[model samples]
Target: MIIGYVTNFNLNQLDFNIKLKIQSDKFISSNCRKQYVKYLLDFEFRKNFHCIGIPIIKDPPKDSFVIGHHFFNDQENRKIGSYIFSYCFEKRHYVNLPDFTFNTLLILSHPKSGMLHFKDRNKRILFIKPKPKYISLCTSREDICGPIFMKQKANIIKKIDIEVDDNCEIGDNCICKNKTLKESENDLKFIYFVPKNTN
Candidate 1:
C-alpha cells in the first residue's frame, strides 16, 4: 500500500511558536490521521511494529507532540526528500515543535539553499542551516536517474524495464523525421550495490 503524508504543524526549526500550531485540533484531525497511514508502503511493519519508548530531549516544549511512522521499500530506496519537512514534522512526528498562530505552512513549504557551519571549542559543533534564498528546480542527479532499488549490504538488483520510443522531440529545430525507422528505441537494465544497514 503506497502511503503519503503531510505534517499537521510546522516541524522545521525548533521554536516555541511552532509548537503551538502542532498541538492545534486542526492539525490532528481524524481525516488527516487516516490519510497519514494510507501512504505506508510497508505492510509487515505496519502490522507487527511496536514503539519501544519515547526519549525526553532537553528543552522540550510543554505542549509539544511527537509521532512516529514507518515505510517499506523492498525494491529500491525511492528519493523521499520531497517529504522531508512534512514527514519530519508531521508524518513521523519524529521531531518536537511548538504551536503558533502564524501560518507555519508558508515558512515550512518555502524552498531554501543547503549550507553548513561549524562552531565549537573542539570544532565538534556543526551548524547546518538552510539558506534564506530559494532555487526553482534544485533537484539532484539521482532524481534525474529516477528511483533506484533499495538493497541490503549485498542484495541482488531487480530488472527494471526502460523503454524509449519515437515520440522523442529533439529541439526547436529538430530534423530526424526522414528516417524510415521513424525513431530509435531501446531498453537498459542494470544493477548496483547497497550497504547492509541502509534500511
Candidate 2:
C-alpha cells in the first residue's frame, strides 16, 4: 500500500521505482523476505526530497522490526543519508532501540525531529522521537555543533532576550526554530502519528 502520495504522477510508477530499488539491493534480497518487505515513501515537494524507509528483516517478529531510512535529494539525484534503527512494540507504543551509528545519533540530536516510517499496517507514519541520550552524544562533535546551535538559536534568543540586529531577518538562516521545543522531560509525549493523507 502507498503510505503517501504525490500529485500529477503515476503512483504505480512510483511504487515500481521503490520496489526496483529494493529488488536491486543484494543485501536486502539476501537477508529480507520479499513478501514481507514494506516501504514507507515520503515526498517533500517543496524541498524536492524523496525519502524511502525499508524494514529489512529476514523473519520479522510480530511485534518488532529493523528498518533503515534512505533519504534522497530528488533534484540532485543523490542520497542525503541512510540510517538504520531497530524498534520494538511495548505498552502500545513502538520504542526505539539504542543501537545507532554515530551518524544516526547526530541526526537524532536535532531538536523535535526524528525518523518517520511505516512499521505496521496502520495508515499513519510512525514518528520516532529522539532519545535524550542520543541527543547528548552529538554535543561532543565539533562539526555538528554549528548546525545544531543555529537551528536552536532562535529559542535561545527568546529565552535570553537577546537583541538581534535590524538587518537580520528570520528565514531559513535564523528564524527556523523547533516548534516542539520544551523543557527536557523523560515523559515528554514522543510517539506521534501523522496521517498519510494530510499532505
Candidate 3:
C-alpha cells in the first residue's frame, strides 16, 4: 500500500541549487532513489521496501503531501538516527512518540551541512539540533534544540501522478546562495484523487 508523509521542512534550501520544482510523480523509497535526498530531510526506516517521502505541501491546490527518499550506507548506526524519530502511520500507533508539544519546533541552518532540522505542519521552524556527542534513545542533542520526527497523516488516497520538467537537484550546480528558477523551468504539475465523503 502507498503512504504519504512530510519530507523536508525547508523547501527553499533543500531545492537550493537543482530547483526541480517538487512534485509527487513517483514512489521514492529510502536509499533507493535520490541519494542526496537523505541529507535533505530525516525520515524513519523500514526493513522492507523503501519509502519516498513526498514534499508536505501545507495545502496543495487540490490535495497532495510529500513522499520521497534516498540512500544511506545501510549501516548498523542506522538505529542511531531512528531513535531520534520514528514514522507514525495510522496503523502503527505507538505511544512512545515524543510528547506532542509546542516549543519543540526550532530552526537550525544548512542541514545538508550538519545534524538535522525539525518543522511543524504549518511549515514553521521547529528544532535545530545536532548529532550528540554521547548519543542515546533520547539524546541531549535533541533535548536542547528539539527532536526531528516524521509524522504522517494518511487516508484512502492512494496514488498521486506527478510530472516535472526536469528531475535534478542543485547539488554542485548551485554554487551561490542567491539562486532562482525562471518561469519556464518552474513547471511542476500534480493530479490525484481523494476518496469522497462516505457518510
Candidate 4:
C-alpha cells in the first residue's frame, strides 16, 4: 500500500511555500479533512511532525514520502484496518507507528514484524510475520536501520528470547541456514537455543 503521513491542511490550506509530495494511488479525501485539523491541535501527537496514513493500494515503494490524508479514522483503536510496527535500532531508539495509509484496497502481502534483534558486531536475529498474499520477505533491514548497519559508535548489549514456528526460515542469506531442521507430525513441542543464548 502507499504509506505516508498526513496533516490538517488541505491541498489549498497548505501555505504556498510548503511543498508536499504525493505518490501514486495516494491522495487527500474529504471524509478525513476535519480529523486532520484536530490531530494538529492534539498534545500527544504534537511531538510527531508527520501523521501517517494506511493507503488502499498494496505494496507501496520503500520510504515513499507522502502526506495529506488529514486525520486518521481511529487513532485510539490501534487495529483499525491498519497494521502497527515497532522498530528498535542499535539496541535502542524505538520507532513505532501505523506503516502507511492511502485511499485504495490495502492488500498486505507480508505479515512480517518490522521489529528486529541483533547480537555482536556481525550477528543478528530477524523476526518476521508473513501475510497470506505475498511470498517475499516481509521485513527489510533498511526499514529498521536505514541503509547501513554501523556499530561500535554505541555499545548495545542485551539478551532476549523469542519463539518461532518450526516451519520458519532464517532468511535466504542468513548464516543460520545450516540450522534448519525437518520435523514430521510426530515431533514433540520444544525450544532450541543458539550458542549465544547458551553462554
Q: Which candidate is the best by lDDT?
A: 2
Error of 1 at 89 (Å): 15
Task: Single out the weakest 10-residue window by summed lDDT for candidate 3.
Answer: 134-143
What tens-digit string does per-residue lDDT give for candidate 4 at 36-57? 1112112122111222233342
How do all the candidates rank in terms of TM-score, highest first? 2, 3, 4, 1
- Evaluated against the true structure, the overall lDDT of model 3 is 0.23
Estimate the TM-score of every prediction.
0.16, 0.23, 0.17, 0.17
- Per TM-score, the best of the predicted structures is 2
Per-residue alpha-carbon lDDT of candidate 3 for residues 150-191, written as tens digits (9 for 90 to 100): 222232111222232242344433211113311110121111
lDDT of 1: 0.22
Model 3 per-residue lDDT at 146: 20
Instruction: Give each model's whole-structure lDDT.
Output: 0.22, 0.26, 0.23, 0.24
Task: Candidate 4: count the clashes.
Answer: 19
lDDT of 1 by residue, 74-149 (tens): 2233421211111122222222222211111112111121211111211211121221111111112112222112
Query: Candidate 2, residue 14: CA error in Å?
Result: 14
What is the Cα-based lDDT of residue 84 in candidate 2?
Answer: 31
Cα lDDT tens digits for candidate 2, 76-127? 3322333232333232222233322212111212233333222221222212
lDDT of 1 at 176: 24
Q: Of 3 and 4, which scores higher on lDDT? A: 4
Candidate 3: deviation at residue 191, Å?
23
